[model samples]
Target: MVYQLIKLLPIKHLPTLLGIAAVLTSALVAPSAQAQTKTHEGWYQVEMIVVARKDDTGQEHWPSNIKLRYPGDWVELKDPNATEVPNTTNNSASATATAPVVDLTKEAFYLLPASERQLNTQAQKLQRNPRFEVLFHNAWRQVITNKKESKAILINGGQTFGQHQALEGSIRLSVATYLELQTNLWLAQFDVNVGQEITQTWPEIPLRPNYTAATINNLSLDSEVEAELEQALANENPQWSNGNFDANAAAPEANNYVTRQIILLQQERDMRTSEVHYIDHPALNVIIQVTPYPSVATTPLPTAQ
Candidate 1:
């Protein structure tokens, strides 16, 4: 068959034909120049599922000595049900701010409905199995930026006891050459035993690790002074990064969780669009997908007659 096919085409022209085919294939598979430049700049819709294993008979051993605590800076996920608070100033004594406004990135970070989740089928399959019990699942949208600019979104679910939830921590999504996911979450069974102290304690840290404290508070300092202050703070506290709100618990809050045992799930992963990624533990498991979503639609031109 190979000999017959080669005979149909002139041997002298085979090199040119192959070269043309290669160029056409590259055009179809490779991304355009514009797309290559903006891979990490645009908005992305993220969906995830968290499930616990009912049976870990054959699972690998996990370390129990490792300590787990919440990160200092984590932003609360924007609630879809809640209205946006406008940053309005009173123009007159009698007038009040009417409308709320924010940048496109912040506006796009709203949580999506469960119906919009792409992993509904996957969740269902896990639910049907006897070895797995679905714990929590949700979907949201945001503008994913580089590692230096990305914010850690606070995540909490499962049974609520007093002021703490069974599952709590933060998920930070960043793009440093590639999409990176960092999860610093912990699962605990809590009780209402008041005054009971736990070993875990959260250190008071800045809300925005990427920004300076003065910037977060809107305090303007001399460039040299700010730089010196940041360096001093960094030297004092290793966790300090020239690093949001009451709901975010970004500043400081009461910790009322009473748990004898806490299981920590800390892992970092590199992911690609349109593919499902899974992070597994002996007691907990996570399934997630991050897809690029455009705020505006693109329509192709009509074909020529």
Candidate 2:
């Protein structure tokens, strides 16, 4: 009946009716297509790799200045293997199923799995390179907030040195008009010449402000602190040696000069989401990428009555 009515209409009117049909078709399809595209605003998956170059000749010599400290507001990445806590609700569950309770106590921030890491190929290349030493590699997911609300994440790896680390510090991420990454990392070198003899390598590192912990200005790496720490180690473990440390093993001499020789890698970089960024230094290098995390509907645990 509608086809018979259209056949009776004038040819000029048919063009206008056909145009209206096309407009209606486009209106129906446009919204669905737009909804399918993911929007990135809040959370992101961040991956980072820190590497030290063995070929850098300048690192072999003691630096003219030294100080090392961590940022005051730094946070350790949540270990997923340690515990299972719910961070999302079961909104996607069927209407027939009981509504799962959302835990208010569970933190919104946590580390994702190693399988979620997208930079395994880059890490493998660095590990395989003879000139490079892979110090720290981590991938975690967290909310990216503005500078005022953003907190720094601790970056630590490599060998241990009496409550300290061979590589220890923090990297911070914040978004203003753009996403930015700030690195305040240090690589601690043991004295190959410590307890041997006061040679030219034993250049005294003067008192310097540990400005690496940008949030804390009062931080200082004093010579007195080093001397006292050395004396304590001397009293506790005479067997303590440089480079290689065995807590049980006895040392041949009193290694009193064991402290941090700070080789810092500090930089501020503005980044775009999903693009890999490289921050390089003479002593160390960092590779990082931040990608938007898709909003996922996770099944929540059933609430107890």
Candidate 3:
């Protein structure tokens, strides 16, 4: 009877068992194969624009040809003509003289191929970036009413009503025709609190603010300040300033040295921002915050034309 039962089972079960084993083996190996295949290529370039509001109110608009490149392949963007300095100011006096050179070129990047170009086009053509409605405020009203919790007569019952307010803003860029290619949306809001380093709540590394070399004055420091600064300088580097020189008397010399060093750094930053390197193709409109990384703390802003 046992032999008969074994024969009835036959060899067909072996193939089924083998098939199940094969499937389990494939499942175990597939994830590693996928992981081995995935890698990120280096950053790419695309085109972008800097659209600023022209009027005091957010109504009227004017389009200027600003040329910028971003990451990845995207829509072809045209470079605008050169820019001119509109205004220049100085502490001593205001002059309409030669405007300081401000390179407006910034490197923009994007994914190689966006999922949908139509959406991108629609956003640009409509002069509005895609945005989500954010309910920031809720309004409420209260009415006087009374209801007896005890066995006494229930005086009254009231209901409260409320509404939500949504905050929305549009992107502005004018062209000859009332058309756009796509919308670039920035849904996130970042609170940037600018204050002195000592009073900040969050841990922050000191960063130099944006300013031109000429902005810093070349005048000498006061007697007391100069004396302290001279001492500090001597402690750090004896060769930077002569220790024997009278602090009050050498105020002019100390001031000139400090001022020139600052100016040099400012100029260096400006030069880096101004340098333009070209690639064979354009990139897509990838958005990255302009905030500098810790390592690049002192790097100049990208020239975003």
Please report how far candidate 1 places residue 159 from its true position, in Å. Answer: 0.9
Candidate 1 lDDT by residue in tens digits, 182-261: 99887665433345555554332212232222213432334443344344435545666535111222221123334445
Per-candidate TM-scores read 0.55, 0.58, 0.15
lDDT of each: 0.57, 0.57, 0.22
State candidate 1's TM-score: 0.55
lDDT of 1: 0.57
Q: Give the better candidate number (1 or 3) by lDDT.
A: 1
Best by TM-score: 2
- Pairs that collide, model 1: 209-243, 211-242
- Best first by TM-score, ranked: 2, 1, 3
Give the residue spans of candidate 2 off by over 4 A: 1-41, 57-67, 84-109, 192-194, 197-257, 296-305
Model 3 Cα lDDT, one tens digit per residue, 1-305: 22232355436333322322232232212121122222121111222222211121122121222221121222212122233464545544555555534222232211213331212332243244222111111111111011111011001001100110011111111111111112322111112112213321221111112211332243344544445555555665566565464434332321122100000000000001111111000111111111111121232322222
Q: How far is 155's C-alpha from truth in model 1 (Å)? A: 0.8
